[model samples]
Target: MPPHHVAWWRPLFLIALMPIGVLGNLEGDALNAFRQSLIDSNNVLESWDPTLVNPCTWYHVTCNVQNSVVRVDLGKAGLSGTLVPQLGLLSNLQYLELYSNDLSGVIPVELGNLTALASLDLYQNNLNGTIPDSLGQLSNLRFLRLNDNSFTGNIPVSLSTITGLQELYLSRNNFTGQAPDFYNLSKLENL
Candidate 1:
């Protein structure tokens, strides 16, 4: 057999570990998940570099004591691009505030992975498309804001699935119709 034959298992093992590697570690998963989204959201702010030492301490990045990224607030910093699907990987993300920018494209359905999200703010931007129904998956969401955009569609009934939702804002958009009534939603302190 060729020298690569025995090493085949190594690649296979690495491949098999990819998903586990992504999900097992929260910080790794979050970085992988938002990798593309962050890239699209701006012109700078690349992934980890020795020059930066730690990415969480960057201007807009916020992290917990464990050095795990938690929030990314980049509002009106001249960011421009479409929403990428990789953002859904941030399982621990609580807030994603990016307003008054020039972002466009569909809000990826992958964001539903952020079940721990508490707030999601994307307004006064150039975004357009359907609000992902997967948002209802965020059981810990307290606020969801998407206004002053060019989206065209009805509110996803999945939104009502969020039992812990306290505030839901979808004003000043292309949404047409009444809100749907989802089921099994508890802790509905506010609408």
Candidate 2:
């Protein structure tokens, strides 16, 4: 065999499968981390066919050529469970909506790690616990809705740091204290 010839037994024989391998890694991580919640909540991925070879082709799922999950929305879904911080592993996630679900858990501080996030809606859920100050790190956030939940404690002033925020909905939560200064939110259009 030539030095450049593909070897059947060699794992490196299929260099083209690298991207598929990456997709598998991502899918495996997502499945492992949110296994229980995903299985319990149809709202998050009601039409998703996990049996498919690639998750990118599933309903409500979008991906780049690399087959990475960029959005996950299950608004008004009948889901119930805590949000696993491992969700932050989707480095490319931009939109995440789980509004009006039966979800109950702390808003993961790790979510603030999603620097590319543009929209986040978890309204009307049964989620309890204080808003994480780490959320202020979503510099690209344009929409934020966390209304009507059982969350308790003072609103995180750090959240006011999102410079691109347009809509801010915190109505009917257990939040207390005055609004944070709006200087960091220069492009804010609605609240």
Candidate 3:
């Protein structure tokens, strides 16, 4: 091929790849933001290098064939800190396992933006505050565990609306108000 043809094809190819690159960057940035908010005493997050284009290469992170983030499995990694709102940017995320960590602060309402989420296990953390109503927006969520946290306030009635929810664990929290009936949750087996 002629040099001019090469030049023409180069730009077009890069443009074609731009969307994938951009998606990786977005997911990487979001996970990096979460890393920044934490104190990783166990060096569990040492692989979270921000210089990477995507978080797929990072430890405890999982991605799909499209290079989009799908799961963040950091359970019991001895991490302590607040959850970043940027995590909501993982649009394809299905599972978020941060259980058994010392993570504190309110659950970011932005997490509600994870519409594709199926299992969200934040159990055994130091997280406090009302469960965000935005979580109700996770219509696909099945297993929702917020147990052993310091969260307070009524169980968001909105959560009752998650028709597919199969496991709801809110035990050992300081939550107030009468327990919301789970009878409407046809798939719910544990509460």
lDDT leader: 3
lDDT of 3 by residue, 93-149 (tens): 999999999999999999999999999999999999999999999999999999999
Error of 1 at 91 (Å): 1.7
* Candidate 2 to truth, TM: 0.81
Per-candidate local distance difference test: 0.71, 0.77, 0.94
Poorest lDDT segment (10 consecutive residues) of candidate 2:
38-47
Better of 1 and 3 by lDDT: 3
lDDT of 2 by residue, 31-133 (tens): 4466456545344454455555656766656776767777876676577778888777777788888888788879888888888889999989988899999
* TM per prediction: 0.71, 0.81, 0.91
- Model 3 ranges off by over 4 Å: 1-17
What's model 2's lDDT at 9?
Answer: 51
Clashes of 3: 0
Clash pairs, model 2 backbone = none
Consecutive 10-residue window with the lowest summed lDDT within model 1: 45-54
Return the top candidate by TM-score: 3
Which residue runs of candidate 2 sit more than 4 Å off their true CA positions? 1-20, 38-53
